[model samples]
Target: MMRQTRLNIRWRLTIWNALAFAFILVAFGIGVYQLLRQAHFDMLDKSLKNRLVTLEESLQEGSSVEDAIRDWVGKFGEHSDYFAFVCDGLQNTVGATATLNQVDINRLLPNLINDYGGTAHDSAFGRIRYASREVQSHGQPLRIYVLAELEHLDEELLLVRRTFLFAIPPALVLSAALSYLLAVRALSPVEKLRLKTDSISATDLHERIAIANPNDEIGHLTATINSLLARLDESFDEIKRFTADASHELRTPIAIIRSEAEMGLHNDADHSRTNKRLSSIVEECGRLTNLTSQLLALSRAESSINKSNMKPISIDRLLTEVVEALEPLA
Candidate 1:
């Protein structure tokens, strides 16, 4: 028994649309997240470099660098921007707007000054970000470190990330809807073909599937199915004609045999003559039977050949068997 496979075009379209939407969502999300992160970090570096330049100018002027830094810190501290510290080349703290803990001054300060000459170094101190800068002032090299807490930046980034996350569902929904609409538009001709196929029946097998677009695969499929239907319709018509012709041709011999048999039986004829007529009638009946059986067998064999599952047989043996079987008839 053959199991029927049911197809639902809408379900197929929905699944494919969802997959495409998911791919676009993931790609866009990753791109947006990376771009935002890069922009945020760049802004932080630029702000730090600008602050370092201002601090350098104060020191070069021989003004009280501490007071200048304190004033600047006072102005910017309310904004929660950064903390600054100035140190000599010997790693001794010369001036600082904000006091540093002993460990930070000892361990991290020297490393920042050594590695980056007139450059910034970003580091983390207990969840806070510090952008440290080394500078030269009045022919003397100095180190200036700026500490800016990243909690607020992280919070904002988190908000942006959450916004993106929230946007994804809507984005995916919109994209899926768009994809489905597009797929439907693209497959409109296929849908029409399906409806036409459903309308087709054995009685209307001569009807061909309509083709709206000839360049597409669906159009090609429509053309091929229509061609197949045409062939099937032609074959059925030929079979009907052949069956009618064969019946007509066989009827005369069959009627003649029946009439001869009846006449022989009715007449009180000689036994030998009666036997001869009976034998002739029997031979005619046998010939008719053989012809009908051959037609049926040929029809069955043709069906099997079309299906292409016939077992391989030796042609020579088959021909010999056919000749032997027909010898009695001959």
Candidate 2:
């Protein structure tokens, strides 16, 4: 039972610790992934918004959409990774960059007016991060859509997911190892206590649990157990003294009964002396019977103190049996 209890404590402690660590690791990984993803998307949206602002400023200078596109191409060169298009209120494509030709533009932008603001998703492109705004271009209201291929961002997110997946197992393993070590350390005192307790028994109640430190919890526990052992040792000593006293009290009566009986048997010719010895033997036998009954009662009381029920003994019946045994000598 002690071994089983120890195992249960150690396992519960280790498992609970490992589980708590795992939860924290998973939560931290999720939080980091979300923050990184949000930051990436925020930067992408800001860049697209800035580009729209530049286009609006160029249009305000009385430049045509085609002229603005030409200026942008000359300044920044061609980037096939980004696509930009301008559509009039009637949904007619007025201006487009060279990158728009790389992908299925119709699939990437199903409805130029519908793909207006925020972000859009496509099976082929994964995430089409974009910014759109209504702007005045050459005395006409135009909608500008700036779209960027999210393949790079998606690749980064995938790498992050892979890193989490690979890192979690090792992190959990390390956590479990650390938890086991902590469990062992925490239960070491308990193990010592158990060993001390196991070494004690009925024959060796004088031995006590050694207290390494008197201030800690384990130390207090050991002190409590030692106090209990001290009490038990005192009780055992009392029982031994009682037993010795009972034996001493019964020995004289037993010796008198035996001696008087032997004298009566050998001096049968002297009737008066034989009768006197018989009377003395009978008196000693009564004392012996009383003493035996008192001892039995004491033993029964001690035994019954720890039991649920006490079995009553017939003292009269025991005395009758003792009298019958003495009848032969009479």
Candidate 3:
């Protein structure tokens, strides 16, 4: 039973430690994944915004809308991730790259004036993130849209998640094993104390538990147990002495009674001498009875001393009570 209890404690310790570590590891993994995802998307949005600036500059330089579209396509079209589109105030697609001509301009610019910032939307070519802005070019207000493919971003994030999933189980197992070892090392002293105490018996009260570190809690516990053992040893020694002394005190009176009885029986014809022998025997018997009573009273007093919560008595009342108790015998 005790061995099972110890094993339960170690297992509980290991389990609690593993739980704490898992919580921290999971939280850290989630945080990293979010930060990385946001950072990657932010990079894509910035690239789109930068392309918008380049297109605006080309228009400001007095280039026609067709020339600006041609320049943008020639510069960034080769990169399959990039797409550019432009529209007039009527929201009609005016100029666009081959990559973006496939996208529905109406859906891409649903709220051209209101949705001026960046956002992600699904398209014919998987998912795409785009940014839009209104700018004056060639003395006319034009809306611009720049979209980037989201497939690569999604793929990168998927890889990160898979790596984390693969790493978690082995980390948790290692943590649990380390926690179990630490728990065992920490409880070794207590286990030793239990084994030592189990080997101790009443006859072996002189033996004490070994103390490894006096400043620690286990050391203090061992010291207390040893002190209790010392007190028990003293009590046992006192009991042995009491028993021996009581027997010794009774032996002399018993021997005297026997001798006087023998003498009285041997002198049966002489009545006076027989009477004197009988009187001596009676006196010894009285002594023996008195000795027995005194021994009982002493034993009671010692027993009371070992017990707790003794009430105090007034000396005058105590003396009066003693005198009253002995008056009948007197």
- The whole-model lDDT of each prediction reads 0.71, 0.80, 0.80
| lDDT, residue 170, model 2 | 97
| Residue runs of model 2 more than 4 Å from their true location after superposition | 1-8, 74-77, 101-103, 111-116, 201-204, 269-283, 299-330
Tell me model 1's lDDT, rounded to 2 decimals.
Answer: 0.71
lDDT of each residue in 1-330, candidate 1, tens digit only: 999986567657877878877887788888988899789877877777677677666766766767768766665564445667777878787776555555556665644543433333335443444565666676788767766666777888899889988988888788778877877887787778888888887788889876877898987999899998998888788788779978886876677677667768786558887886777777767878968876776677656753334468899997975564343334
Question: Which regions of candidate 3 fall more than 4 Å away from where they truly are?
Answer: 1-7, 111-114, 242-330
Model 2, 1-330: lDDT tens per residue?
565534587788889988999999999999999999999998888877777777767777889998887776676567765668777887677888876653456666673345546667877666677778888866799877777878888999999999999999999999899898999999999998998798899999998777999999999999999999999999899799888999898876776778788888899999998998888777777878878877777776776753334569799998996675555456
Residue range with the least summed lDDT across 10 consecutive positions in model 1: 113-122
lDDT: worst 10-residue window of model 2: 302-311
Off by over 4 Å in 1: 1-7, 60-79, 98-114, 117-126, 135-141, 178-188, 293-330
TM-score of 3: 0.73
Q: lDDT by residue for model 3 over 75-112, one digit each (tens)?
A: 76667888778888877787887666535566666533
